[model samples]
Every structure is written in C-alpha cells, then in structure tokens.
Target: MLLKGKTAIVTGASRGIGKAIALGLAREGAQVVLAARSAVSREGGLEGSIQETAASVEALGGQALPVQCDVTQEESVQAMVQAALAAFGTVDILVNNAGVAFFYPITETPLKRWETVLRVNLTGAFLCARAVLPAMIARKKGSIINISSLAADERDAGTVPTGVAYGVAKAGLDRFTYGLAVEVGQFNIAVNGLKPKEPVDTEGMRFWTKPEERQGWVSADKMVKCALFLAAQDASGVTGTVSTDEELSLWHGL
Candidate 1:
C-alpha cells in the first residue's frame, strides 16, 4: 500500500486517464476525490462518471468523494477543493489530468476551440495547483502531477494531427511543472509533468485518432501505473521533471 492513509484529488475523473488514476490510488489505499464537469458521462463518449469512479474507489475499500468541477472556472475549481477538504481534511496528492484537444490547422481552427483547449489544459492546472498549495505547503509534503502530451515536444513540421493550442498548452504545463517544482521544493512539495510515451486508448484519443492508428496505443492501466509512481514518490525522490511513461518506468524500474 504505497499510498496508505493518503488523500488524493483527481481532476477530470469521470473517465479515461483521470478515472484510471483515481481507481489506482484507491487500490493503493488512498482516499480519493473525483472531480469533473459532470456526475454522469457526457453524450457521444465512452461510459464513465464521477459517481461511478467514486463507487469504484469505495469498492476498493477507500473513501471517495464525487465533486463537480469545471476546471476552466476558478470558482468551480475552488469549490471543488473546498469540498475535498471538507470531506478529507487535507490533500496529499493532486493529479491535474483534465484536458481537451481538437485537431485543426491554425487557419482552420476556431478561436473558441483554441481558447477552450488552453483554458482547460493549462489554466485549469494553474488553478488546481494554487488551491492545493496552501495545505501542501503547511503540511510540508505533497505531489502534483500535471498530465502533459508528447505533442509538446514534437517539432516535425505539418506532421502533427493535434491543434497548435494543445501543444502550446502542454508546453506551458511542462514549464509550469518546472517553475512550480523549484518554488515549492523548499517546502518539500514535488511537482512534475507526466505523459504517455505512446498514446493511450482513451475516449478522447479514439475520437481524435484514426481507427488503424489506435492499434499500437497503450492501455489506460499504463497511465494509471505511471501516475502511481509519481504520486508515491517523496519530494526528495522526484520533482521538477517532465517525463514520459517509458522514461519514468525505466528510471524507477517499474
């Protein structure tokens, strides 16, 4: 039980990577808060919900709280954190895994779509991190894992299927991980970014990728395991890094 007696908040926990991480933490004995825009799965996506995830956690013998959060809204994010604190006392881990992406050429991409991606992917992480830092700093221990993308590092021109906003936001997230890690290191809080070395077979990925392209994708379990590795580490053990699943697994011998 690597995370026994700990409490964790996982954003966008209705489905995909976020849901997997929530369940994984619970299996390791961490009480979990599942936060997302809805308690039920949205139309036209895979089946999942905050309530469902919470139930899964409870079934694993861990406490669970389901919180409705629109990460793009600071008020919503704050309310979600308050709800978590009311239920769990203090947060030991925060997984900033809520995100959105739409693939389009710059000229073809709508401004609203571009802005929405940035708001959810980058600004949301900022708000959640701010909300948890006070308690974590006071406790002198915490782990923040920012979900990032390999698209942030891809430089081959005109090859990427993802929109510019997605890449830019993830790159910004990586920078945030680095800067925040340095700032909070003195308080013994660890911050880092983690992304799949290969794409995960997530609902979002299914929608965005070609059917044939999905064949080589990794399972959601891989993301969950990688997140566990990050969450279980102490500040001295890991911080201020942006790494892929493969990189982390090799480094930690997972």
Candidate 2:
C-alpha cells in the first residue's frame, strides 16, 4: 500500500475524477475525507454521492469521512479542513479537484457565469490550500495536488474550448501550484499541478459533448492512477511540477 496510514482530503469527491481518486487512495490504505456540496448526485451530473463514496471507501477497509463542503466559501473550506482533522487526526494529502467549467464564447458568456467559474476553480483552490497548510506544515510533510485541465491552453480544431474563464482559471491554478510549491517546499510539502492529457469520460463531459465526439476519451482509472502517483511522492521529490497524465505515467513508469 503506497499510501498506508495516510489521510487524504479530496474536494469534489461526489463523482467523476475526484470520486475515482478518492476511491483509489482508499484502496491503497489511505483514510479519505470525501468533501462536496451534495450528499448525492442531486444536480443530475453523475451517479455517486458523498455518502455512497464514503461507504465504498469503508468497504475497501479504509476510514472515510463525508463532509458537505462548498469550496467556494472560505468558512466552508476551513470547516471542512477542521472536520478532516477531527476525523482522521491530520491531513497528509489534499487533492484540489473541485471545479466547474463553462463552454461558451465570451460574447455569449454572462458576467456571473464567468465569475462563478473563476471563483470555483481558482479561488476555491486557494482557500483549500490555505486551510490545509497549517496542519501540513506542522507535520513537516504533505502533498497538495491541484487538478488542472488541458483547457488551460486554447484548443485546436479537433477539440472544443472549455471557455475563456475556465482556461484563465486553470492557468491561474497552475501558477498557484508552482508558487505554493516553492513557498511550502521548506516545510516538506509537495505541491503540483496535474492536467489530463486526454479527456476523461466523465458524466459532465458526456453532458457537454456528443457520444461520437468523445470516442477516444480516456477512462477515469487513468486519472486515478496519475493522482495516486502524485500523492505517493515523498516530500523531497517531484514538487512544483505541471504535468499531464501521459507525462506522469511516463515519468513514474506506470
């Protein structure tokens, strides 16, 4: 078990890549804190829920704590962090996987929608990182994985862009990952940004694109593997990286 005796706090863990990462960590003997806004997939995006995810983690013989968290709110993030600490003693890992994407041109995008995307994707990461750093620094060891996206770059002809706001937000997150890594490296915390090389076949992706358009999409398992690799890194290794799934697989020889 690469993560034996570790405790991880995963945001947006109710479904999709976040849920898969939480399950994968649990299977590797990590206690997991499942944080998300909904207990279930009440918003009609995916199938899993915080309750269901926690139960699955326990079924894998790992501890699990389900907390309803709105990462966009600072108090909510702080409370979630406290809940994790209360449940598992301390957090050894934090996966900033909570995010929202809007796929529209700037001309059609509403100011509120753009702001919402940035708030959830960028500011939320900052809040969660801030909330977890004290515990991690005190322990002098930890990992922070920021879930970035290929959408950080402008898309080409074969793909659709994830909107200007999402791209900008993820770009900001990547910068945050690097800057945070530098600042926290002295405390033995590894911070890195991970982007999917290919689109994962997530429910949200399915809702956005047609079946035929996503024929070559990767499975959530690949992302889980990549996340596991990052989370398992020692404090002295692989900090301040912005890597893709394929890149991580190659580097870690997965």
Candidate 3:
C-alpha cells in the first residue's frame, strides 16, 4: 500500500485513463475523489460515469466520492476541490486527466471549437492545479500528474486530422508541468506529465479512434500502474519529465 491513508482527486475519472488511475490509487489505499461533468447521463460521450467508477472503487475496499465538475468552469472546479476536502481531510494527489480534442484542419477549425478544446484540455488543468496547489504547498507533500498525448511531440502534417489547438494545448500542458514542478519543488510537490502513444480502449477512445486499430495502444490499466508509480515515493526526485507507459514499466518493473 504505497499510498496508504492518502487522498487523491482524479478529474475525468468516470472512465478511460482517468478511471484506471482512480482505481489504481484506491488499490494502493488512497481514498479517491472521482470528478467528472456528469456521471449518469449518456450525453457528452462520457463512458461509465463517475458514479460507476466510485462504485468500483468501493468494491475494492476503498472509499470514493463522486463529484460533478465541469473542469472548464472555474466555479465548478473550485467546488469540486472543496467537496473533496470536505469528504476527505486533505488532498495528497491531483490527477489532471480531464481533456478534449478537436480533430480538424487548422483552416476549417472554428474559433468556438478551438476555444472549447483549449478550455477543457489546458485551462481546465490549470484551474484544477491552481485550486489544489495552496493545500498541497501547505502540506509540503503532494503529487500532480497531468495527462498529455504523444501528438504533442509529433508534427501534425503526418498525423491524422487533428487541429493546431489540440497539439498546442498539450504542448502547453507539458510546459505547465515543467514550470509548476520548478516552482513547487521546494515545497515537496511533484508535477509531471504522462503521454500515451495511442488511445486507451474506452468508450471515449472508440469514438475518437478506430476501434479495431486500438489493439496496439497502451492499456488503461498499464497507464494507471505507471501513474501510481509516479505518485509513489520512488519518484521523489523525478519532476518536470514527460513519461510514457513503456518507459515507466521498464523503470518500475510494472
């Protein structure tokens, strides 16, 4: 139980990589606060929902608090963080896994679409991190993991029809991780980024990628394990690094 007695707040935790990370933290003895926009409705392409994830966490002998939060909204993010603190005494970990992508050519990309993607993918992460940083600094012990994508490193010309917004936002997230890490290292707060080569198999992935072609993609469980390793003490000296599932498994023997 590497995270025994810890409390973790995982955004977009209803399913996919987020759900996997929440469950992984719970397995390590952390009380997980699962945050998502809506847990029950089938709208917005969200799969399984936060309530479902929370139930699974409880089934594993861990406590769970399902919180409704639209990460793009500052008030919603603040409420979610406050709710987590109310449910649990403090937050020891924050996983910024909530994101959105707009797959389109730059010329055809609508301003609203670009803004939505940026708000959810980058600004949302910023809001959540800002809301949690003060507490984490006060405790002087915390881990913040931002979920990014490999597309951030690749050139858009050769890849699928993904607009500049998604790529630029993810790249910004990576820079955010580095800047936050440097600023908070003295407070014993670790901030790092995780990038997946391909989409994990989830309802969201099915909608975003070719379902049959997702076999070669990294498993959500594998990513979750990597996230746990990052959240552990073994990564005490590691910060500002963007890691992958393969690299993490090799380094942590997962």
Candidate 4:
C-alpha cells in the first residue's frame, strides 16, 4: 500500500510494461489512469487495450480511468491530464512509458520513421511531463518515472540493432530526466529514468526473439517493484539519475 490515496497516469498502458506497471500501481492503492493510443485492441501486433487494462484495475478493487492518448500530440496529452484531474482531483505520479522503435538501418530508415521515433520516445515524455508538472508543483509532492532503455548508453551498441533513432531518443530522455530533476527539486518533485537490466519479455521482444531464446528475458512484471520504489520518491529521495531494475530493487531491498 505504498501508493495508497495516490492517482497515477501511465501512458502506453495498453499492454506490456505499461500495463504491468498500471496494475501494480492499482494493487498498491492508486487509482490509475490508463492512457494508450487505442481504447480497443489494435488490429495487428500485440492484442491488449486500455479498456482491458482498466477492467483489470477495477477487478483488483481500484478505481480506473482509461484514456485514449496520442502522446505525440500536445492537445491529446493535455486532454488526458485534464481527464485525470477531473476524475481524481490531483495527479500524484506520472509514468512516461509510451514509445516506438524502427529497427532498420539509418540509411534505409525513412525521414518520417525517424521523426516518429523522436516524437514518441523523446518528445512525448517531454509533453507529458510538461502537462503534469503544474499539478505536482502545486502539491509539492510527486514522482515522474521515464521508462528508459540500456540503449541510452554507448556501451550498449548491440542493442541498437540496425537502427539508431531509438537509442538516440532514449539517450535524450535520460538527459531530460537529469535536467528536470534538478529544476524541479525546489518543488520536491522527483524525476528519474528506469530501465530493464536485461531484455524484457514484452510483446515486442517476444516478436523479435525466438521462443526458446526468450527464456533469459525478464518478465514485464519484474519492473513493478522498481517502479513502486520510484513512485514513492520526491526530491529528498532518489531522483535525477537513470537506474536499472536491479539497482532500484537492491536499493529498496525488494
């Protein structure tokens, strides 16, 4: 019950890591606002929706609000936050988990694809953080966790595969976390980036990896404990840095 009485907004909450975190928050007593690109399951790819996530949250006896949000669009992000505020009074946590990736080579990648990566992975976090900061500052208590990746570091070059935009976007996101944490500390707002220590068995990862080969990948649920710790943070506690799941887990003794 670490998050009792809190209201959290989780973007990209239709499935995978986002969905897992949303449910984890709800279990901890937060009324979660599930934000995703679609209300219903998309026709292709992985099959889950904000509606499904909302249903699960409510099933766990927590209040839920499902919002269709295009994180890349300012208006959409604004509307989503307003919906949360209208329903819950205040936002106590924000999880920037929405993202997109293009794995082809830079030479083969289209301009639109490159822009899309930046918009969703980097700019989307920027927009959502901007939208929620006013409320957090007013309360002088809030946590903003950016779901980042190992690709942010140059040592993880293999993670880039054939493309580069995804890594570039994540790196920018890390910098954003650091800078924002420093700026918002005066208001007691905590901002930090969290990432999986190993490959996660998310829908996208399962698609890219062979079934047998996926045994080593961690489950998306493994992130919840780390996320839970971050969700409880403020300027006085951990903030301003990017941490792996292992780091936060050990730090919190989970």
For all predicted structures, in order, the TM-scores are 0.96, 0.96, 0.93, 0.96
In candidate 2, the residue pairs with backbone N, CA or C atoms under 3 Å apart (3 or more residues apart, or in different chains) clash, namely none
lDDT of 3 by residue, 59-137 (tens): 9999999999999999999999999988887889999999878778878889999999899989999999999988888
Summarize candidate 2's per-residue lDDT along 37-147 as a digit string, tens digits.
988767545677899888888888888999999999999999999999988889999999998888888999999999999999999999999999999999999999999
What overall lDDT goes with each candidate model? Answer: 0.89, 0.90, 0.85, 0.90
Tens digits of per-residue lDDT for model 1, 1-254: 99999999999999889989999999999999999987987777667889988888888788899999999999999999999888889999999999998788899888899999999999999999999999999999999999999988887543337688899999999999999999999989989899988778777777777776666677887778889989986589799999998898898888
Segments in model 3 whose C-alpha atoms lie over 4 Å from true places? 156-160
Over 115-222, each residue of candidate 4 has an lDDT whose tens digit, in order, gives 999999999999999999999999999999999988778554463252588889999999999999999999999999999987877776666556766656778766
Better of 1 and 4 by lDDT: 4
Worst 10 residues of 3 by lDDT: 154-163
lDDT of 2 at 66: 96
Q: Which residue pairs clash within candidate 4?
A: none
How much is the lDDT of residue 37 in candidate 3?
A: 81
Off by over 4 Å in 2: 43-46, 155-158
lDDT of candidate model 1 versus the reference: 0.89
